[model samples]
Target: MTQLTPSPAGTEGARDAGDPLAEGRSRAGWWHARWVVPSALAVGYALSVLFRLSLVTDQDHPTVSPDEQMYLVMARFLAGRPTTEIPGDQIIPSGYSLLISPALRLTQEPVHAYHLIMGINALVSCLMLPLAYWALRRLNVSRPVSYAVGVAAATLPTVLFYTQYAMADTPLPVLVLLWLIGVHGLFSEGSGRRRVWFGLLAGLAAGYCLLTHDRGGVIIALTAVVLLAALAFNWAPRVASALALASLGVMFVVKKLMTAWLMARIDGARPSEVGNAVFDTLANTQLMRRTVMRCVGHLWYFMTSTWGLGALALVVCVYVVFSKRFGLADRVVAFLMVALLAGITLAAAAGLPADGRIDTITYARYLSPLAPVYILVAMAALYRVRGWKKIAALGTAASAVTLVLLAVLLRLAGAELVKSYFVVWGLPDATFLSSLWPANGDWGGFHAGRTTVIALLVLAVVLLLRLLAGNRRAALATGVAGLSLAVFAGVASAAITERITEPRTKGTQGIAAGFIEAAGIRPGDRMVMDDGLVWEIRATMTFMVLDGRVWSRALNKNAPVPAEADVAVFALADQQAPATDSWRNAPAGWHVDRDVREHQFVVWRRR
Candidate 1:
């Protein structure tokens, strides 16, 4: 009505004109988008998974460690079929045992089931890569830097190696990472619906972490300190206090629910029995000290060992601390570092034995949850330099050189260490350590191959450095170097599999399973063994008939065998005095089935 002149075609065209270059830039940005981080992580993780699956051995099925076997038995019992007759030790955490039940259901074969559990763990761990990247991006790190960090994390040797194994350490890191992401979000945006949501998620993650492993409490403590600091800085005093209380309430509820569920699973004893065992383990003074020393030793080893990246992180941490450019993020990172150090120190001071028998120190797996924070701090410190491009270039060059040297040195050191240990222990010089190779089943070829692999790795590093020389892009150079190193590592890993694990056609699980199947063992048949192999047997067979009396009597000043035993499985066939003749010269009614295929396993059955 205001006599708006009809817009001319040219005017309309001018109005509709869009900046092509800007549009192009925006579209190209998707490649480095935050969402793409997870995709990249998934790719890397898929490769790792494929690599691990390729190396799977049905022959050497899941060899239960003394600790793993105990958990397996508990899981088996909890699955509603109590196979073992031995008095269930309350030493295993009820919470962890409860979690293992679901894992056991995925497969009928214990080893396959364990692998499936570990595979889930690995997937969970891989998901942490995206979480880590998101946190870094939220903290305002450049896209390239964030992606680089994710790649590094995804390919970390320690992470990759542990993910392939069935252990609590794998899931612990994932939960810790998720918790950290929630913590970071809460701190970055204080006191809102988002913050509340993050707080709840953090609580849930922390609670789940605790269910997986005991050291999750340490992760919660570290997270709380950060949230507290954020609240103090950003919110009104009373409001902040209220928010903190609310967070605690949420955490408490989650903890209570998890605890209740775990406690409900205890069949014979009160929940306090499990708690007491944990307390007793922690209260061991010698164990605590040794564990602390071991942590310190591992940290030292990580820094100085053949891992150049760790060494670089250590150097950067020292440099940033002294540079006087410390900011709030620096302080936050510093606090976490202090907390981890304190945790380790306190754990060590608790007198944990040097042998790692203490809960905190024994596994060293407890420290895994803190690993991401450590890496983040190191990366953040390096990023603080203003003219970082030049520094990054120099660092990349240095890293390349260091990596080559480290790889070579690691190979040489490993060979020497194996040679020394085997020679000193009077073990077979298997071509590959612990593998059935070298024709004579000795390690002579393994030592030689170890040296050759080291040399090849060094050469590969040299080639990689040369390829990187002309590359000016820091991100590109880092990617190339990382990928090259990862490839070389993969090759070396394959060689290890070929040499160490391949030759043993009948792995522990296969051997145990085969024996049980061949013996016509049924679901109700009881089997007793005086060795660690009993768990494998129990897993393969339907029942474990070994009475606690057998072990108890053996421990009681070498007491005689129990009168009720229908079958006896002795691990050590060489030791004769301990009922060896009685077993060897058994009557026709009591036949002896000697299995010397893998190791000497004797089964004495009453006819």
Candidate 2:
């Protein structure tokens, strides 16, 4: 943890004399400059929304990120629906659903509601630009630099790629940034009243983040620790700490209440999902080896997912974090970044899908909330070393090459320490290694190995230019090249993902609703699904199902059924449900009303 130095009181945009981050006492509040006002930021917000909206395809439903179906189902419940098929155990936090559920209430058609939710996502996601700009400004980063970074982040694939999906991740980065800034604000301010306000706001952001996704749990925990430290260490006023803790407690109570309410309205939506199973991997002593391997793999995936840009950011952050010259807020934010990466990595490791697929090793979405930080590093690198030493810049360049070499080393070393873990688990998918050698031109028929060689040799050129030539232009050019490469990589990834996702989504957009309409299943109909069906088909069908549903295939075999069920969706085309267990499913007496053989399911209406 970085040492804390309390900042003196100043106006909203006024200069604070006690702030060590200040360039000078007179110019302390440069981030509060006339041009950086809220009205000026409106343009960036509008443009960001437009760009994201342009990315929206005709498909109103989820194309990727399977959790979208679950989210929308939960949203429907929150939109004042009386009954729901989704269980409490399977539901996500209510925060994001609260944001999008209104869309469902405002319109009757699912398509219209989806577009509205997409618009909300765009608007919410774009909040990053202004928030990022403000945060950098407060850190004493120059105005032009802050604005550039903000714009760059808005367009980056990490921000744009998820906007098309109706998931909490869409607004997550913004929420994370807000929580971070609030922490910095509360701790730095001199006024007790302002500190209280900042603390409450921080709690609000932290709590809502939890409501939006399970990852928010990490944020809340961090918030509690930070606040308690503030009080115990006498870093912040007692009142401020107390209030923040209070807000967090209140938010937690709200989460419980919301869950209880939703659960009561649902059928058999038990609390099993929140139990010991989630921590099974972490609890077992025998799995320690696998857990350690998972942690390492997750960390590497998070950094390399940005294709080495994060390595440079990590370098800059190391200096700003430990060095005494930087302000407490800057150092703390950096510390939280590292902490968040660690927290998410560990959590993902503990709750891994247990599928043993290699892609699970390098899954990047777990750390997507940190995307803005990489752009910040990229932009910060472009500036000359002012208060800091030149070693930071040089080390940043070297770090990128270092990462490339490490990737090579992993390939050479076969990552032997963890390689066996994969072999023992299941088939090691070589494709997961694609994260390490990104942009190797596989699609263009250029060999990945050759591309790796080219990248290594070019970075070598960059290092030599710094060490031998020793010119400042070389430094600036290097930063520009790195930033450009990062942008190019991000855009390429976004394009590839969109291209792959859009067509599939468009083709199958109407699966659930089509089946409902085809079979004339009414809104009040009770539905049952074959629990044996794979998640892809089941989630799709479940998303379109009417409220009040059951999961039982035994009903197809004349087993006792739920007291009421109007329709049953099963994969069996000609045969009845498999005689697995009668009590586990509902009773039979269904007439096949529709057979969508292409999807491998048929809708049977109760006779």
Candidate 3:
């Protein structure tokens, strides 16, 4: 048996001589190549999916976030009556609910359906890894460097966490990354036809973003500005113009469709209230300054809290800038980062209210898409350091640290802050990690687990350093080993602790489903649930309007309950309106039913 030696630089030069872009492009095709980064992303995301599924063990019944419940309720309402009041319009776009309706139909389980859709969203977002690598390579970065960045992005905790949840951030980032890749491709390899195709993709992305959430519109606007600036600088005027046109056309079409749908639904109902006073107040400098400050304060908390990894990377990038090792790409990245940061600041200044709660939630999830960019910039800075082994070692170390910290923070703090942050921002907390640490728990176990994970991570980093200084191939192998071990240990620890402390809520969905089935709902059977349980109930029975009472009460102050609901599902432990003898006393033929445990669901036949 003859042993084959590694290819020399001379042979590599010959390969490149055959085709200039060949070497760069070949990296994309390499087994552990830049393209393979998406595979790692897929693995991470798969873990996220499993973790989320574990949280909602019963597929027939699922535990959904407030926003998700809102979507489910709205979608079910639209599917049946087509004339029901659209719930949570301000926080979430109607398009999302509409999109989710089809998924709900397939699963026949609201929570399961929600997670399934979110998993798809997460998978789509992970696809950005390969697309981003393609863009980086097109920008003339080495294939290995590009691949490394791609892998880093795939394994990013922020991205992985959000990917498996039913929220706008999952799809929004995927769209943005796709847009970036298209923009890069248009400038680098696109002909007139390619420009047109790229433009269409860009437009579709912008439209999707706009329809998904209000803040998403900001992404479109920023994209337009960036494209125009690039054109002005002669980067690719024709391509930019095409993209601009495509984006505008798509936005117009999406807006028209949404408006038509809204108008059709609200034809007989009261018109949506327009508040010019609030709008005018937002234009005022004093109010704007206060709002901006409040938003910034919230943003600061979000950065330091669960998203500390992205924050740490950003801090590192800033440190790199001060060290005076900036390149042309770095400058461009810096400018784009500043532009995005400034845009967020300006948006907060323009829109957020002085009240801290509203501002924080509104802007918290908005920072997610920016997280990838922050990581990318940090990776770019890391790549600027000479020696491939150093790059690999540092990248591995940074990734390990980030993963460990995120896991620790999540386990210790619980997901209240994370969930609250997104809800405040009009986004859903759909990520797998978010569900791991529920609000009620000691959180000490999580803290302890994090400490252990971090220790292991630090050891892995030290081992990585040793591998780097000695043998090149061994360093690469060791880096991979360290990452694998850290991820495995972190996830396993979380799984075991979660299971031990809070075993899977047994057949929780069955009880909820049982209530719906027992109700014998009719076409015009109006139902109201205290905590939006009616949304889940709708999956089992037909109801004219299954209003989410809790969300309604929270969002609409002075909104009264309909006097003639066919059924009322109330939680026994509801603090808002506790179950009492008076509550049980209804009209003479009204029947009240209790579940297996401490739960009360009523069925009232109108007399």
TM-score of each: 0.65, 0.79, 0.63
**Each candidate's clash count:** 22, 4, 5
Instruction: Give per-residue lDDT, candidate 1, residue 556.
Output: 18
Tens-place lDDT digits, model 3, residues 508-601: 3444455545555444456545443444443333212332221222101224445655554544435444334314434455555433223444
- Summarize candidate 2's per-residue lDDT along 184-231 as a digit string, tens digits: 888785678877888888888898887777888888888888888878
**TM-score-sorted candidate list, best first:** 2, 1, 3
Single out the weakest 10-residue window by summed lDDT for candidate 2.
423-432
lDDT of candidates 1 onward, in order: 0.46, 0.61, 0.46
Off by over 4 Å in 1: 1-24, 27-42, 57-60, 77-90, 93-100, 224-295, 314-330, 345-352, 355-373, 376-472, 478-511, 514-520, 530-607
Question: For residue 560, what is the lDDT in candidate 3?
Answer: 46
The collision pairs in model 2 are: 555-586, 559-587, 560-587, 561-587
Winning model by TM-score: 2
